[model samples]
Target: MTIVATSTSAFYERSRANMKDLRLKAESLQAQVGSGEKLSRSSDDPVAAARLRTLSRLEKLATIDTSNADRASADLSLADSAMSNMSTAIIRAQELATQAASTTLTDDQRAGIATELDEIQKDLLALANSRDSNGHALFGGESSGNAYEFDASGNATYIGTGNSQSLPIGDGQTMDSSMTGPQIFEFTDANGNTTDVMATIKALSEALKGGSTDPTGSANDALASLKSGLDTLSTAQTVVGTRLAWLDTVAERNTNLSELRANEKSDLGGVDMTEAIASLQETLTILQASQASFTKLAGLSLFNNLS
Candidate 1:
């Protein structure tokens, strides 16, 4: 009969390796339970880790999109408010023009109305050249400076060079952040004449100073122009209002999508706390049993007997 001998060093080394393996497994389970993440590295589960990375990138992009949406909404809101003010100013100008159209008013009274109209024109021009939150021209289109500038003839002219500003708020979604100065304030009248509201107001103010042979006829013309100008302002307000409503809808959709992505990410990468805690307890129990068994076997060694 042949007898096989196992070296004491081999037994000790194997026992040490087994204990190390058991301890490592217990520690891993503990980490999963504590941190609420299943895998610490991609090597733990390559496919799941890859999916998690994609989700993380998407989440990061969503955060940026949300910020863009906020900025765009703010810009559009400022534009809407400015347009509303313009509409109110135009309405008040219409009232003044109607009052000046009365033959009962004297030249001095008409001149007084013109002075007020001049002030209103200046206010309207200032509103047209207003700045947004970014300090850029609100209606400047692509231009960085004022949207409207006065020519040598003192006529307010659109100095902007492009369409209104736009921003991407979300996936497949873009919003116009502003409207061009010309689009808001300049429109063709029924007479096929390109009417600039600022210029119309200027004309009305000049006519109110009473130099025409038929003063009442000139006043009536100014009143008609003022009515057309009010219509233009009203149309602009409607456009801005529609855009603002669209932004609200899109912003709500973006928020819902972001929340859905967060939930999906949690399902993909987040740990199941109950399962992890149970696994940790099981691993700890096994580690303790292994340690106790190793201690008992080591005590039975012949080296211990000799000692």
Candidate 2:
């Protein structure tokens, strides 16, 4: 008969290894419970970790898109307000022109109207050069300076770019932040000639101040041009309103997408506290039983039995 003998040291070593393994498993579960995360490291679940990384990147991009959308909305709102005030000023100018066109008004009255028109021109220029929320030109079309500038002869000229800047909101969507100065102020008159609100007001004021052969003729001529400029401003306001509406839609969509991403992240990475705690308790119970068994077995020996 063949006999196999196991050394006491080998038995102790095997028991220690088994206890160590249980201890390690208990510790891992505890860490998971405390940290509230399923995977402690990427290697724990590489696929889930990679998906989490992608979700994090998308969240960052969504944040940027939200910021840009907010800025664009602000600038567009400012432009809309400025245009509303400008429209009011233009309507007032038209009324003043109608008064000046009447032959019953005295020279002094016409001069008084001219003074008010000059003030209105300055107001228009200020509105055209209005600043945005960031203190930059609102109608300058991405330029840093004013949208309009006056020459030595008091002629107002548009110095802004031809087109405004377009900002990306999200999901491959983009919108113009604001309209250019010329888009709001300049248009084709009834005579098929290009004219602007500021220039028309300045010319009318000059004529009323004796710069023209016939002041009433000049006032009548400016009415058509002023009306055309107001139409252009109104059209621009509609465009801005449409863009703001679109931004609102994009914001809602982005919010939904953000919520979805958060849910996905929670599903992939978040630990279930109830399950983790139950598993940890079960593991600890097994470890304790094994430890007690080892303690009793280790104390048992042939010498003790003989004693």
Candidate 3:
């Protein structure tokens, strides 16, 4: 018969190693239960960890897109309101121009109308230079200052950029936040001339105040240009409305994407609390049984039993 001899130290060492491994596994499962996360480190599940990182980056980008969309919506709304007010001012000016074109009006009444028209011009200039949510020029096309600057002669000139700024709202899409001052105010007149609302109003005000050879004739001529300016403003309002609608659509899409990302993140990284707790309990019970068995075996000596 062949007899195999094992050292007591080796037996104890093996028992301790097995118990330590079981303890570590139990602790890991407990951590997952408490933390509600399946991964303690990237090494736990490299593929899932990498995917989680990607999702986190995408969520951050979605947040930025939401901010940009909000800003664009605000600026567009402000532009719409300002344009509506401009249309109102233009309609009032049209009525005054009709009154001034009458031959029955005296020179004094014409002068009064000119003064009112000048006030309206100032109002229009103020609207053109309206500030955006960030306190920058609303219609200045990314310029920091006013859209129009007045000179010594009080004639307004466009000092803003020709094109409005485009902002990214997400999903690889971009939208213009606002329209430039010239876009809403300038149009081709009846004389085949490029003219703006401010210029038309200024010229009429001057003519009504005796700056022209014939006041009634000048008022009659301005009617066509004013009508053109109003039409231009209406077109701009429509454009703004369309952009706002597009933003709403993009917002809804972004919201759905956000929800999808959240669900994916939960599935990839979130721990199932019930399963984790049950596993932890089972591991603890086995660990306890192993520990008690090891203690009992370590205390049992062949020499003591023989004695």
Candidate 4:
């Protein structure tokens, strides 16, 4: 039977290609074992690579969420402290009203108390216009300036937007970071009258200075208004405190989720050094055997044993 002609050049070419492929595979395993990563390119395992990419994206998002949570918590904490101080100021005003309402104090003494109350009013206004960590007005509600502004009449008017500031703390979760100035300082009393604490204190101060015919009655009214303001401040503090607690819960959940994602990423892309090393050893043995066979075959040329 006539044998089909097989070119020596073709044999050499095929053997070189096979040997190169085996060497590349062996090197790849070695790299995996050294670097502790499964693949250097997405082409090696597209599914795993895609999953890893998604995990990376989520990790970045979680970091951002955590920062937002921290900012919101801090802002709310400042708000609580400020409200607590406001409550204390109102309580002091209440005490002064009780003392001033007594018939024992002279007009001069009542005016002195009013002067101090005016100073407290100034303090309250400053507190209402307090700035946050970012230098924006804490109660401004998207406004960069003071939350409450004084008119030409020296009447305090809320210039801030009525909406409260809110922040995203996690997936599908958002929290109000601040309350409006009006909501904290201007609350309706049981008599259905809108009570402005600043104005009430100012009115009380003026009444004590003999602006009202019935100074004792005005003091009693002021005392009642101050009590309402205390309630408003306490409610605001409660709201802020509740939000802070929610943020803490969200923060914990985010941390746990981040850890879970990291573990999954490790499982998907991390290399098993022991398995890679064993595979590299097997690949090297196969390459060596193939090289020896090729070398022996290459030595047997058509002209080697020709007569």
Better of 3 and 4 by lDDT: 3
Writing each residue's lDDT as its tens digit, candidate 4 over 30-57 gives 8888888886899999999999999999
Compared to the true structure, candidate 2 yields what TM-score? Answer: 0.91
Error of model 3, residue 152, in angstroms: 1.9
Task: Name the candidate that leads on TM-score.
Answer: 3
What is the alpha-carbon lDDT of model 1 when measured against the actual structure?
0.82
lDDT of each: 0.82, 0.89, 0.92, 0.86
Q: For residues 119-145, what per-residue lDDT tens digits would candidate 1 score against the true structure?
A: 889889999999988999999997889
Whole-model alpha-carbon lDDT for candidate 2? 0.89
RMSD of 4: 3.1
Candidate 2 lowest-lDDT run of ten:
1-10
Over 1-307, each residue of candidate 3 has an lDDT whose tens digit, in order, gives 1121346656778999999999999999989988889999999899999999999999999999999999999999999999999999999999999999998989899999999999899999999999988999999998989999888898889999988988999878999999999999999988788989989999999998889889999999989889999999999999999999999999999999999999998899999998888989999999999999988876778724533
Best-first order by lDDT:
3, 2, 4, 1
Assess candidate 4 and give its lDDT. 0.86
Worst 10 residues of 1 by lDDT: 1-10
lDDT of 2 by residue, 141-250 (tens): 88889999888888988888877888888888888899998888889887788889988998899889888888998999888888888899999999999999989999
